[model samples]
Target: MNIVVIGAGLTGANAVEELRNQGYAGDITLIGAEPHLPYERPPLSKGLLLGTAEPGSVFAHDHDWYADHQVDLRLGSPVTELDLGRRRVGVTGTQIAYDRLLLATGASPRRLPLAEPSNPDVVYLRTLDDALRLRARLTGHILIIGAGWIGLEVAAAARQADATVTVVEAGSLPLLGVLGPELAPLFVGLHREHGVDLRLSTTVDSLTGTQVDLSDGTRIHADTVLVGIGAKPEDQLAAQAGLATDNGVLVDARLRTSDPHVCAAGDVANHDHPRLRRLRVEHWDNAIQQGKHAARTMLGDDTPYVRQPYFFTDQYDLGMEYVGHVGHAGYDEVVIRGDADTRVLTAFWIRDNEVRAGMHLNDWDAIDPIRSLVEQGTTDLDALRDPEAALPVPSG
Candidate 1:
C-alpha cells in the first residue's frame, strides 16, 4: 500500500513509526514543510527557549532512522494540492499517489493583528527555528502578548535567562479560559513569584516601533515581543480536498475523515471523542496517542479512540499535569488536597459528585490516582479532599 502522511510533526512521525512497528510492509511517505526532521514542539517553549535542551534532543527520531526503516522522509516538501479522485498529492512540481493518507498537519501560532506584520524582533514560539531565534534575543526586556500557556512558559524561560519579562493578558487571570477563574490564580501566582511582570485585563492597542500602546492609556517599551495568543489548526489541505471541517478536520471515533481512505490525527483532527464528545486537542500526549490510534485504525483495527485528554506544563518551580476533560462551563466544585499557597496541591473538579478533571501542581505522584478517580467516577468528596485518602479500586 502507498501510505502518504501529509505532515512530519510528532503525530505524522509517530503514525509512520507505529505503522512500521505494527509490521506494515507498505510504502510510507512522510512529508514535512519544515526543513528539519520531525521534532517534539513542547520543548520549544520551555527547555529549548531556556537553552537547557539540545536542539537534536527534541526530534522524534534521528535523521538516519527513516532510511534504515525503509520509509520515505520528505523534508521541506509541502503538499500544495490534494486530488481526492486520483488519490494524488501535488507538491513542488511533483505528485505522489497514495492508497491511504493521514493528515497530521498540526497547528500554527496566531499572530497579533495590530502588531507589525514582519518585525525581526517579534517572535512566535511554534517551531525549533522560532525557539532558537527567541533564545538569542532573551537578553533584553521581553514583552509577551497573551497570558496563555505559551506566553507564560516563554515568560518563565525569559526570566530564567535574566531578561525582564512582562505578560499582557486581556483576561483577568492567566489560563482563565482553560483552567477557569478559580484555578487560574495559581498560574498567575507562579509567574509573579518568578519575577514576571503580569499585566492582566490589558489589551494592546497599537505597536509603535518597539513601544506597545495599551488600552489602559499606558505605553511600555520592549526590546522584543513574543505573541502567544493561541493557535489555529492547519486544516486547509483537508478542507480543499472536500473533507468536512469545522474547527479542524472532522473525524469519526476511529479517526476516519469524510473520505474512507483519508484519516487525521493530532491538532488538525476534530475527533468525535467518546468522553469529550466532538473536540480538538492540541497536546503532546494527544498527538502521540492519536497518531498510534490512527495507524491502528488504518491497519483494520476497529477499536475506538476513548482515552481521556491529558496535558502538562512546567514553569519555574511549578510543574503541572492535568487529566480528564472539563468544558468552558468550569467545574461544579474544586476540591483541594494540599495547600494552594504552599505551591503543592492537587485540585479535582467534581461534577455531579463525580470527578470530571484533576490537576496536580508540583505534585507529580498524584497523576495516577487522579486518573483512577476520573476513570472510576469516584464521588466521595471527603476522601478526595484528603491528601492521605487511598484511591478507590474500580468495581467490575
Candidate 2:
C-alpha cells in the first residue's frame, strides 16, 4: 500500500507518525512546501519571536525518527494538483500514485492590502521563516493590526522583549469574533497590564512607511507592523478535486472526505464534530488529536475522535485556557469567579444551566471540574460556579 500525506505542518507530521505506530507497513510519503522539516507552531510566535529558542529545538520529532520509520520525507515539494480519477497527485513535474491521501494543507497568514513596492517593515508571523524575520525587526514600537490570538501572543512576546506594542482591533473588543464579548475584556486588560497600547474599534486605511492611518483620523508611528487579522483555509485542492467544502474541506466524524480514500485534518478541515454537531475549529490541540484520529481511522480502526476541544495561550505571566465548545446562542448567562478588571479569574459560559465553555486567567486549578460538567451535560449552574461545592459524582 502506498500512502501520501500533504502539508508538513502539525497535522501532517502527526498523521504520518500515527500511521506507522498503528502497525502500517505501507510505503508512506510526506510532502512539505516549506524548506524546513515539521516544527511546532505555538513556539514560533513566543520563544522564536522573543529570541529565547535554543538551537535545533523545533522539530516535532528528530530527523532520525523518519529514517527509523522508513518514511519518505519530501521537503520543499508541494502538491500542485490532486487527480482523483488517476489516484495520483501532481507534484512539481511528477505524478505520485497513492492508495490513500491525507490533505493536511494548513492555513496561510492573512496579508494586508498594500500597494506595489511593499514596505520591508511590515511583518506577518506565521511560518518559521516569518518568525525569524520578525524577531530581528521587532526592536521597539511595533504595531499589530489585529487583536486575535496570534496578534496578542506576538504582542506578549514583544512586550517581554521590552518592545512597545500597540494592537488595533476593528471590533468593539479584542477576540470578540472568536471567544465573544463575554471573554474579550479579560484579554484587553491582560494586554494593558503588560504595557501594550490596545486600540479598539479602529480600522486601518493604509500603511505609509512607519505611520498607520486609521479611519478614525489617527496616525500611529510604528517601527514595524505585524498583521494577524485572520487565516483563510487552503481548501482549493479539496474543492477542486470535487470534494464537498464549506469554509474548509468538509470531513465526517471518521475524518473521511467526500472521497473515502481522501481525508483531511487540522486547521483546513471543517469536520462534523460529534458533540458540537458541526464545527470548523483551527485549534492546535484539535489538529494534533484529529490527525491522530484520522490516521487511526485510515488504518481500519473505527474509533471515533471523542476528545473535547482545548486550546491555551500565554500572555505576560498569565495563562489563558479554554475547553469544550460554545456557540453564540448557547451562552444565556455568564458566571465570573474572579475579578475581570484585575485579570485574575475564570468566566464560565452557561447554557441551559450547564457549563458549556469557560475562559480561565491564572485559574488552571478550576478547569477540570468545569470540563466534567460540560461533558456530563449537567445543568446545575449554581453548584458549578461555586468552587467549594462538591461536584456531582458520576454514576457507573
Query: Which candidate number has the best TM-score?
Result: 1
Model 1: residue 354 alpha-carbon error in angstroms: 2.2
TM-score of each model, in listed order: 0.97, 0.94
| Residue range with the least summed lDDT across 10 consecutive positions in model 1 | 387-396
Give the per-residue lDDT of model 2 (tens digit) for 180-227.
777777778878988999989898987888788887898989999888
Candidate 2 root-mean-square deviation in Å = 1.9
lDDT tens digits, residue span 47-157, model 1: 888888989899999988999998899999989999999999999999999999999999998888877777777778898998898889998899999998889888998
Tell how far residue 305 is off in model 2, in angstroms.
Answer: 2.3
| lDDT value for model 1 | 0.89
Clashes of each: 0, 0
Q: List ranges where model 2 is wrong by over 4 Å.
A: 115-117, 390-396
Off by over 4 Å in 1: 393-396
lDDT of each: 0.89, 0.83
